[model samples]
Target: MPFTPITAEQRFVLDHVVRVRELAATERFAAASDDVIDAVLEGVGAFAAGEWAPLLRAGDTVGARWTPEGVRMPDGYAEAYHDYVDGGWGTIGVPEAHGGQGLPFAIQTAVLDTLGTANMAFALCPTLTVGAIEALAHHGSAEQQRLYLPHLATGAWTGTMNLTEPQAGSDVGALRTTATPLGDGTWRIKGTKIFISFGDHDMAENIVHLVLARTPDAPVGTKGISLFLVPKFRLDEDGRPGAANDVRVVSIEHKMGLHASPTCVLSFGDHDDCVGELIGPEHGGMRAMFTMMNNARLNVGLQGVQAAEAATQAAVAYALERVQSARAGGTSRDAVRIVEHPDVRRMLMRMKAQTQAARALVYYAAGQVDRAGSGDARARGRLELVTPLAKAHGTDLGNEVASLGIQVHGGMGYIEETGAAQFFRDVRITSIYEGTNGIQAADLVGRKLALGREASGGGVFAELIADMRDEAQDARLIALIDACEATGQALADASTDDRLAASYPFLTMVSVATCGWLMERQGRAATDDAPFMRMKRACVRFYLEQIVPEALGLVAAAQAPADVLYAVEAELFAE
Candidate 1:
């Protein structure tokens, strides 16, 4: 099946659930007028479905090839990438001062969501480049920004984030990559970094690597770490690709999915000459890397939305066409399409509801990003509190929806020939890469829940719950809100062990409540009885009637103490 962009649905969510017009009211995003927004939605939707969708199967089957010289992308991958760059799709979110359109970040999120739906592996290239653009725009020296931002913004050169070494995955403080300052104002970066996405490929002229490393005399742990700009090709005096920078792709991983994107193991300064430039102040790598990681976490969440959208489309199409058993309560005894079956309808409705809900949640987070860009300090606080929810819940929905898609397909979904399984395999990494969903849940309880605490003992999380209660008063949502407040207070007062034990369920409760509120907004705004509106109302009703009520069940788990988990003796578990 050719992938189709859910352009109309995206526009509806933007107009109703998140309200992108509010962003247009501000000076920073005034250029994002309705006309521009519509053109972008229609134009990028066409570009993605036409240019990128054709490569989906080939990207998975042929994958990227590795040689000692470098990594070679699958056939047509380079042409497709250049087509994306030439069409200016990559410039939507970058600042106009850096040769971009300077639209709201939410718009960029929409663009990536559409593109990733078409071809997810291919979309990873630009996703990382966008993160690079953000980090450089904020922390790079004027010279660094002037030299790199334009190319990165235009996709002339790509970028990568190299933080995961073999020994340091989540425990980033354990990294041993070293950066030694050279007298000529450059640093020599030496170490092997693993799991570098888009580390090297034939698509771009150069790859700019943002590396995290420690100085020789720096302190231990993350406090000693610093960020560096280590390009695959050093820039010439005129600031174009010049000498080779001694960063070699040791090998690319043979992964279960995302084959088109080269997950490279990179060896820097193997020949004793990897030149790098400092990004921010010395020993401030975590802060700088967090800028990139935060952007990536949201985009990763969008990937979940992407997978859900694609899987939902495929499942719905198949269900409508494939004939199965006779309708359960119909007059005709003859076989009917599986979609007519009540059980299959239930699965399909669940998939659609989850997809829309996740999209709204992610887009709302993006809107917060735009508000933060407009210098709303409270918006920043709200964004931080919602980030983990959006990241963890969105991806969790993706996995769940894709699994349900397979179930809807019966025997066909398990086979790769139908392409249904690919959605699950490709999306499986999103929840893992940008901080595991488990880690995101922990962050929600550990850090974000207490953000911006006022003297009144309420903070950003409390404020958000209040807003939700004010906006949505449905009984299902109110129950969730009450549970969320009660559990949040309990976690706040609980011990460290208890908090960690309750984190995952608490994250789920808050996420469902948030989505329930957005779904209600969407349901209310969908007033007409047209086909789209009818289906919209039906999905909303299903979500509220079926899905939202489940959050109440999780309340018990959310408040369960740590003793239940620790009661199992660790040594006895092996028995």
Candidate 2:
């Protein structure tokens, strides 16, 4: 029931996507090669094993406590945070100017999985900090960056994205928090933002809130929304904490999981004389915030993979040690461990394969981000196109793999103490937060595929299909390729009409297809001696038999006409 490290299967799939090695003698990764990435992977694995692994049960058992000033974290949470920061794990992906290691995004993702798997609640504090750095880098004024970036990158003060209100979940257009712009540069903001992470805490001196509120004279809906930098404690020119900012943690939520992470009900403008400054241009806040959104979505996908990987390894270990029923050909006198049975072996195999496939897909997306943002034009174009798919598909892989992990544990999974339930609960939020799977799929259909269609999209997909065909010499890879082709065709056949109704199911098929495709590629690309290659082959076979059938139905449903979505018989239920 304990969380574990990357399985053989995960390493194999991700290997296809990332080039791992130790860092070179040279200090920087800008001119550095795979060695930097390799050392990063090793460092992450070591950190998870040595530090974070032992904290899983403790994090859950002693979740954060609420007090009059703010919520207090676990006993050793602060020390752990310091370890991660002092070790430079927190700033690996950011630029050098902001105290970041400034390594490749792919390497950063590889390391993030380790932290997430160790303790999602504890991992979250810094995860949000990284996102804040990304946002501030993109939108913060020069002065703001100088004041905040250094502190945030060093984890001196954490940051939170305040976009969600009670009335405004997905619909930012409905946001009503008013940012009253003063005659001077600053403004007095007043509104409540719920579900704000690290909103009020003693963990750091100041909290830089990237709050979303409407300007008084602004237009209604999303157009009126703007980004404001409201610190928990105002900073002086030397960057020391000064007067208190208006934002406060009125109360924290008692949630299903990640209890260690205080989900605060934050009051932004409750106090008059609450000082705030605009991040980017007025009313352009939503546009600027997307930097964080895109980054967050990718991290969430990694979380999905991390949870599944940890759960998969734990389940396998449990199956290895825990004695259960007798083997198929064995007598009642000799009961075998769960690992000895085909069905149990099959379950373990499924978990391993899915986790690996997901890891590969998420890592692949990280590579694309580097390429897309790089100076290379082709890399940029291809990355923009694949971003949504990576986020959506990776998350789907996470959920499916975690579900298998739970099922593998049988009754033990249903119990909270076993820890599989925590993974299940934590993973649920991946698809919900960082933009729902539906939103991700919509992004794929509306942005990636649509743009692909316009900009030689057919050729892009054709090349993808052709790549599989090119590698069709291998029998196992061929079968995976075929399954992927089937799923992709079904997805291509979908339109906006029925999508609203069957969106979840339809996107589920796409995710399966995408991961299956990657599995095939990883298998084709792997060496015979690699355990991951063998794991990929096993998952490819299992997915073909079990998960592919679901895709068939999803495809059939996606093939339905748009109007059919509303053809439901609600009256039948009433009767």
Best by lDDT: 1
List ranges where model 1 is wrong by over 4 Å.
none
Lowest lDDT 10-residue stretch of candidate 1 = 448-457
| TM-score of model number 1 | 0.99
Mind giving the per-residue lDDT tens digits that candidate 1 earns over 55-139? 8999999999999889999888899889989999999999999989999999999999999999888999999999999899989
The clash count of every prediction, one per candidate, is: 0, 7
Candidate 2: regions farther than 4 A off: 1-4, 7-15, 19-32, 331-333, 457-495, 528-537, 540-553, 568-575
Give lDDT for model 1: 0.92
